[model samples]
Target chain A: MTRLTRSAALGAVGMLAASAPAFAQSIDEKVNEAFANSTGWFVSFIFSPFPGTTFPWIVMWLVVAATVFTLYFGFVQFRTFGHAIRLVRGDYSDPNDAGEVSHFQALATALSGTVGLGNIAGVAVAVGIGGPGATFWMILAGLLGMASKFTECTLGVKYRNEYADGTVSGGPMYYMTKGFAERGLPGGRFLAILFSIFCILGALGGGNMFQANQAHAQLTNVVGDYPGWITGVIFAGIVFAVIVGGLKSIAKVTEKVVPIMGVMYVATAVVILIMNADMIGWAFGQIFAGAFTGLGVAGGMVGALIQGFKRAAFSNEAGVGSAAIAHSAVRTKEPITEGFVSLLEPFIDTVVICTMTALVIIITQQLIIDETTGLYMLNEAGTAIATVDGNSGVALTSAAFSSAFGWFQYVLALAVILFAFSTMISWSYYGLKAWTYLFGEGKTTELVFKVIFCIFVVIGAAASLGPVIDFSDAAIFAMAVVNIFALYFLMPIVRGELGSYLDRLQSGKIKKYN
Target chain B: MPSKIVVGFDGSESAKRALDFAVAQAKAKGAGIVIAHVLEWSPYSFLTPTELEERHKRRGEELARAETALLKPVVDSLKDSGVEVSTALKYGHIAETLASVTKAESASQIVIGRTGHSSLSSRLFGSVAGSLAQAAPVPVTIVP
Candidate 1:
C-alpha cells in the first residue's frame, strides 16, 4: 500500500513537471484576461443592479417561500422525516402502492438526480461567491427544502395516474393538470404544459448538457483533450442504454450508485480533512471572515447573505420541484415515505458534500481570481462573461483540491465525470417523467425524448455552454417559483398525510420487521 | 466455530445495532468479539497549542464516556456467550483504525451496521462498506 501510494505520488509529480511549462503559459494568459474582463465588465454589469439581479431575486423568493411554506405546513420537513425514514424502511410496505418503484428506490432515484453537480460545482460556486457564511444559509436552505420536497412529493403521489396496464405517470404536469382541475383552478393545463416544456428543456440543459459539459471540461482539463466529443458520445450511449429500461433500470442503478457514490465522496473529503488536519481551523476562520466581512462586490453584509443563500439554494436544489418528479415514482401507498427519504437528499448533497468542497477550498489558499483574466470575478460572471459568476468552472474545485492533495486533481476529474454522468442520467429521467405526463406514455414518444436527450450530451460537450447552463440554472430556480407556490396551496394535504403517518409511528403500530 | 467478529460502537442507532448483532453472533458461534470506537480530534486546530490540546483531551473523555455507555449493553448481552469479549477506543483514520483493531485483537471478521439504504448503494461508485471491502485486508459483514 505504501509503495502504491508512493508510486502514485511520484507519477503525479512527474506529470506536474512535464506539464508545468505549458500549464504555466496558459495560466499566465488566463490571469491577464481575467483581470482585464473583471475590470471592464464586472463592475458595470454585475455589481450595479446587484439587489435586483435575477439570481438574487429568484433565490431570495424561493428561500422566503420555502421557509414560509414550511412554517405554514408546521415544518412538515421535520414532522415527516421519521415517517419518510419508515417509508424507506418498508415498515408500512404496501405492495399496492401505485408508484413504479419502492419508497426507498424513489428516494434513491431522486437523490441520484439531486445529488450530483450541485453538491460539487454548485457548492464550490456558492462558497466561492458568498464566502463561508454562505454555508450557514445553505444549511438553512436545505432544512427549508425538506418542506418543499414534502409538498411536491405528496402532490406527486396524490395526483399520480395509473394506466389500465398499471404504468405510472406523474410530476408537476399531473399535479397541475389533475390537481388544479380538482381545485377548480384555471390555467392548470397550460401551466402544466409549460412546466413539461421546461422540464424537457431542463433535463436536456441543466441535467444532460450541463452535466456533460462540466464532466467533459474536467476530463479534458485533467487528462488533456481527448476529442472532447468522445466523452459525450460514450456518456450518451451509456445513459441511453440505461434510460431505455425506464424507471426500473434507473431505480436499480440509482439505489446502488447513489449511496455508494455519496459515501465515497464524503469519505474522500474526510480523508482530505484528515490529511490536512492542521488547516481545518484556518479554513473555518477564513469562511467566517469572508462571509461576514463581505468581499465588497454588491455592497455590505446583506449582499453577502443573498449571495450565500442563492448559492446554497442553487447547490442543493431543495425546493426546485425537480427531485419531486423522481420521488413521485416510488412504489408505496404512503406519499410521506418517499418524502422522508427525499429529505436526506439535501443533507447529503449540501450539508455534507458541499461542506466538504467548501472546506477543501477554505483549507487550501486558492483565491477566486480568474485564471484566464487574473482579475477577481464577481457574482454575475455567468451572464456577463458567459461563465458562472465570472469564475472558472469545476476547475475552481479541482484547483482547490490540488492545492492540498497534489494528485487530487486527477481524482476530482474522475469524480466530476461520475458526478456529471450520474446527474445527466437522472435528469433525463426527470425530463422523461415530465414528458410522459404531458404526452401520452407511448413507447415511441419516450424513445424520441431519450434520443434528443442523448444528442444533447454530445452538443453539451462540443459547445461552450456557459450561457445555456446559466439559463437552465435560472430555469431550475424559476421552477421553484411556481412549484413552491403550488406547495403553499397543497401544504394542507401534506400535513394531514404526515399527521396520520406520525400517528401510526407514535402508536408503535409500524414494527421494525414484518 | 462461527467466525470471530469485531464491531465499532459510537452510540449511533446503526452502531448500537451492529454491536447487538455482533454480540448475538459471538454468543451463537462461541467466538471472540471486540467492540471499538474512534475519537477524532476536532479540526479546530487554530487555537493555541495548549488550548487545542485541552479541547482534544475534553473531546477524548466525552467520546470515551459515550463509547462506554454504548458498549455496556453489548457486554451484558455476551456475558453467557463464553466468547472472549473486549472493547477498544482509539483515535485516527476510521478504516485504518478499524483494520488495526481487527488485527491487534486477532479477530478474523469485521461487522459494520449499514446506514439506512446504505447496503443498496453498491451501484453507486463510492460506498463505505464497498470501499472498505476493497481496501481492507480482511472480510467484512455489513449488517443492514
Candidate 2:
C-alpha cells in the first residue's frame, strides 16, 4: 500500500505540473470550447440520457419489480419493522448464540459502510445533475430497494458456511450454489460462480478503488499534497490493522463511528434547512414540478425521472447486493432479523440524507446551470463559474455550503474524507471476502489483492477514469440484474424463514432475553 | 498441569456467569486463569502518532489497575482451593485476541457470554454471539 501510494503521489504531482497551463485558462472557456465542437456517433443519442426511452424503461422495470416483490412478500418489510427494532435492542438475543457482534452493532457496522458518501456526495450529484424530479425517482428507487435487501440478506444467513472449527462464512455464493444444489438445479454452481465474479468486480472498483480514490481526493483537496503516496499508504495501513483483527474489530469500530457520523451529518443538514425555512416549500415544489412537469434544464420530464432514479439507485444501492455482503456477517441464526434491519439502509441513505442534500442545494437556488454560448455554466452565488477539471455539481454543493457557513468547505471536505475512507475500508473487506470465496483464503493471497486495491485508490484519484467508473457503476447496478432474477426463485425460502422467525417472536420465545 | 482458560467479562450477568465457568473449569482442571475486558476507543485511526501512543499507554495502565481489582476475588478463591490463577486485560478485537491468548497460554477452551437471543426481539434484528463463535478459531462455550 505504501509503495503504491508513493508512486501515485509522484504521478499526481507530475500531472498537476503538466496541466498548470490548462488551469490558468479558466474552466468556463475550456468547457465552452469542449461543448462547442463536441461530436459523437449518432447512435450515442439513444443512450444520451434523454427522458423518454432511456429513463422510463429502466425506472418502470425497477418500480414493477419492487411492486411485484412487495405484493408477493405481503409487505414483509413493513410488517417486520418493529421486530427489527427489537432485534437490534437485543430483546431476543441469546448469549450462547454464535456470532460476531450484537444485532445492533451489526446493523451499525453495516450502516457505517452503506450510509456514507452515497447519501452526501451521491445524493448531491443525483439532484444537481438530474434536477428536482430526481428526488422523486430516488425515493421510488429506495422504496423498491427494501425488497431486494430482504431477499439477499435472508439468503446470506440461510446459506452461511459453518467451518469445521464452527466458524461461519456465508453470502450470495452460499445461497446461489448451495440453495440451487438443493433444488436439483444443475447450473447452480455456474450461477454462483457468476455471482461471485460480479461481487469481486464490484467490490474492487466501486467498493475499494472508488472509495479510496474519493477519500484521497478529499484529503488532498482539504489538506493539500501529502507525500503523494502518504494518503493511500496510511489509509491502507489503517485497513490492514483492523482487518487483520477481523470482523469483530470492524464491527466495534463501525458501531461507535457510524452513529457519531450519522448524527453529525443529519444535524448539519437539518440546521441548514431550518435556517432556510422559507425555501422548504419552494424546494419541494421544484422537486414535484421537475419530476412530473419535465421542464427541467436537462431534458424533459422523462429525463428528470431517469436522472432521479439513477442517482437514487446509485446512492441507496438497494438491489446491488453489496450491502448484503456486510449484513451477512451479522450474528443471528434468524436471517430475517438482519433482513428487517437491512431495509432501514435505503431509508436512511436515500430518503433522509439524500433528500436533505437536495433541499440544501435547491433551497440555496443552486440546482440549475446557466446557459452561456452552447455550454452550461454552473451557477455559484449568481455568478456563472465553470468547474476546473469539470467538477460542477457536488463541488458546487460544497461552494453553496461555504457560501452559507464560513469555513463550511472544510467541514464538507472532512466529511467527504471520512465518508470516503470508511466506505473504502468496508468495501475492501467485502471485495476481499468475495475474492477469498472464489479463490481460497491465505495471507499471501490476501496481501496481493490488498496491494492492488490500494493502487486503484491512487489511480482513481490521479486521473479521470471516466470509462472505468462508468463500467464499474454499471457492473454494480448489474448485480441487481442477476440478483433480482435469482431472488424470484428464492422468495419462498425467505417467506418460510420469515414465518418461522415471526412465529417464534409471537410465541414469546425470544422476549425473555431482552 | 492443565493449561489456563481465558474468559471475557463485561459486567453483565451472563458475563459474570461466563467468568464463573472459566474460573471453575480452570480450578477443576488445576490450570491458571486469564480474565479480559475490551475497552473500545473511538477514532483511533485519526489520532496523531504521539497521541495514539499516549492513549495506548494510558489504556495499558488502566487495564493493569483494573486487572488486579477484577481478578482479586477469583484469585483469592482459586488460591484457597489450591488453584493457580492469572488475569490479563487487553484492548482491540476481543474475539481474535482471546483466540490468540488462548493459544499463547495453551488454554484448552474459551467461555463467552451469550445473552439469550432466541427471544422475539432477536428474531427480528439479530445477535453477535453466533458470529463470534463461528469466527473464533477455538472451541467457545457460551454462558447464558
Candidate 3:
C-alpha cells in the first residue's frame, strides 16, 4: 500500500509537469482578463470609499471593531497572553476533555493559515506604498487585532456543536447562530448564513487563489517564467491529496511545515538584521518618524495608517473570524482557554514575523528614499517603489535578503512556496467547514466543494494579480463586516467566559497537570 | 468473591513476564486476574468531521483486533486454570486507563512491564510506568 501510494504520488507529479507546456499563453491572458473584468465591479463596491473620504470603509469597519474589542475586554490580549502560552503548552488541558486537537496543534494550524505570503510580500507592499511609517501602524493594528481574535474564538468554543462521534463544527456560523439564539437576539440565522457565504468565498479567494498566485510569482522569480497553470496543476494535486486525507493530514503537515518555515524565515531575517546590526536603531527611527510626519511619501501619515491597518488585517486575520474555526477544535472544556491561546496568533504572525520582514526592507535601504526630499523614489508609473529585476512584493523581499547573502533568494523562494502550500492546505479546511455548513454535510457535497476548490488553485495561479487581490480583499473584508456584528453582540459572553475562567484560575480551582 | 489483581498486557515479552507475576500473586493470594490492554489514543484537533467519523470506525476495528488477536488466546489458555481470569480493552493514555480499569474492577494492585521502547521521548515526557507510579490510585508493580 505504501509503495502504491508513493508511485501514485510520483505519477501525479510527472503528469503535472508533462502537461505544463500545453497551457497556451493566449489562454493565460484570456483567463486573467476574464477574472479582472468579472470581479472588478464587486471588488470596487466592497472596497468603496467612505463618504467624502479616500479611506475604504471596509478597512475602517475592521479597525473600529478591533479597537472596540480591545477596550471592551479591558485588554485581555495583554493580561492573558502568558496564560495563553501555558494553554498551548497543554499545561491547563485536562486529558479527559472532549475535543479533537490539542491547544498547540490548533494554534499551529491557525498560524499556518495566517502566516503566509502576507508576512513576506504584503509587508513589502505596505512599506512600498505607506512607507516605513506603515510598519508602526501595522504593529499597532496587530496588537489591537489580538483582542478581536480573543472575543470571536471564545464565543466559537462556547457555542460549538460537539457530535456523538467526538467531532466538532464551529466558527462564526455556529457562534453567530447559536450564540444569538441564546441571547434571544433575532437575525442570528441570517447573520450566520452571511458569515458562511463570505467564509467560503474568502477561503477560495484569499486562502487558495492569493496563495497560489504569490507562490507562482516567487517560483517564477527563482526559475525562468513558466505558465502559471503549470504551478497551479502541481499545487492543486498536492493540496487535493492532503485535504482529501482530511484535517488530520492537513494538521500533520502544517504542524511541521508552519514551524519549519516560520523558524527558517525568522532565523534568516534575524541573521540579516544582526549582520546589519549597526543600522537597527536607524530603521526604528525611520519607522517612527515616517509614521507621524509621512516622510514625504505620497499620501503621508494617513496613507501609512490605512496600508498598515489593511495589511495587518489581511496578514493576521484576527477580526475576520476564520482563526476561530481553527481554534475552536482544541481539546478543552474551558472555552476561554482556546481564546487565550488564539490571541497569540496575531502577535506571532504580524507583530513578530511581519515586523521582521518590514525591518529587513527598511534596514537594507531597499526603498530608495531620496535624501533631500525625504521621500521614497517613484517608479515609472509614478508610484513609490522598491524593486529587484523589476519585481516587487515577494521579489522585493527576496532582494532585501539577498543583499545580505547572495544565495538568500533561493531560500526565500522555497520558504514562500512552503508558506503558500501550508496556507492553501489550512484554508481548504476552513473553506470546507464553511462549505459543509452552507451545503449540508455529506460525502458528495464535500467532494464537490473540494474539487471546485482545487480547480480554483489553477484559476488563482493562472489569473492576474489585479482580480486576485481584489477578490481576496473583498471576500475577507466581507467576512469581517458580518463577523464584527456578531462580535458586538457576543462580547459580553466572551467577557463572562474570561471572567469565570480567570476567577477559577486565580482561586486555584483550575488545576494544571502538566 | 476473591480479590482481583489487574495486569497490563500487550503480547510483548515483558508483558508476558508481568502477566506471569500477576498470576503468581493471584495464586498466592487466592485472587482473580483481570488482563487489561490499553491502546494509546489521543484526540487530534486537526481532524475534519468526515475524518473523525472514519476514525471512530477504525477505533472499533482496532479494539476488536486487540481483543481477538491478542487477548482472547491468553484468556482461553488460562480459562482451564484454577485461578479466575477475565479481559479488558480500552483506548486512552495507557497508565491512566490501566489505573481506571484497576479501580473499576476493584483490583488490589496493578502489574505492568517496564517498557523496552525507551527513547528520548520517554526521557523527556517520562514513561507510562513512571507516570503510573505517580498517578495510579493502586499500588503498581513493574516487572522487568
The candidate that wins on lDDT is: 3
TM-score (2 decimals) of chain A in model 2 = 0.81
> Each candidate: how many clashes?
25, 38, 4
Q: Tens digit of lDDT per residue, candidate 1, span A1-514?
A: 1336634643564465455656643543453344344334322332233365534456667778778768877877776666566666666663222112445556655666667777777766666656655666677777777667667877886777655534455677778777777767787787777777767777777787778878877866765644435556666766776666443444344445556766777787788788889988877765566567654434345555766676667666666777766666555556666667777777666767778877876566555445684333454543211123234557777777766678877767766776676677667777877787777668899899989998878766655544545645755665666666666666677778777877887888655443
Q: List runs of model 1 lying over 4 Å from the truth.
A: A1-55, A80-83, A91-100, A244-258, A295-303, A368-391, A508-514, B1-144
Q: What share of the true interface contacts does each candidate keep?
A: 0.00, 0.00, 0.16
Among all windows of 10 consecutive residues in model 1 chain A, the one with the lowest summed lDDT is A381-390
User: Candidate 2: where is the Cα deviation over 4 Å?
Assistant: A1-52, A56-63, A95-100, A216-258, A369-393, B1-144
lDDT by residue (tens digit), candidate 3, B10-123? 999999999989998998999999999988865433433234324434555677799899999999878767789988787678888899889889999999998777899999
Cα lDDT tens digits, model 2, B1-144, are 667777876667888888778778877787776776655432122321112213324444666666666656655665665556676555545565576667767877788888864887656745446656766666888887
Q: Is candidate 1 or candidate 2 better by DockQ?
A: 2
TM-score leader: 3
Interface RMSD of each: 23.5, 12.1, 5.2
Q: Choose the strongest candidate by DockQ.
A: 3
Write model 2 residue lDDT over A44-86, tens digit each, in one string.
3313443644553444555566677778888876787777777
Tens digit of lDDT per residue, candidate 1, span B27-70? Answer: 77777788877554312111211121133244445655756676
Docking class of 3: incorrect
Clash tally for model 3: 4
TM-score-best of 2 and 3 = 3
Model 3: colliding residue pairs: A100-B44, A100-B45, A101-B44, A101-B45
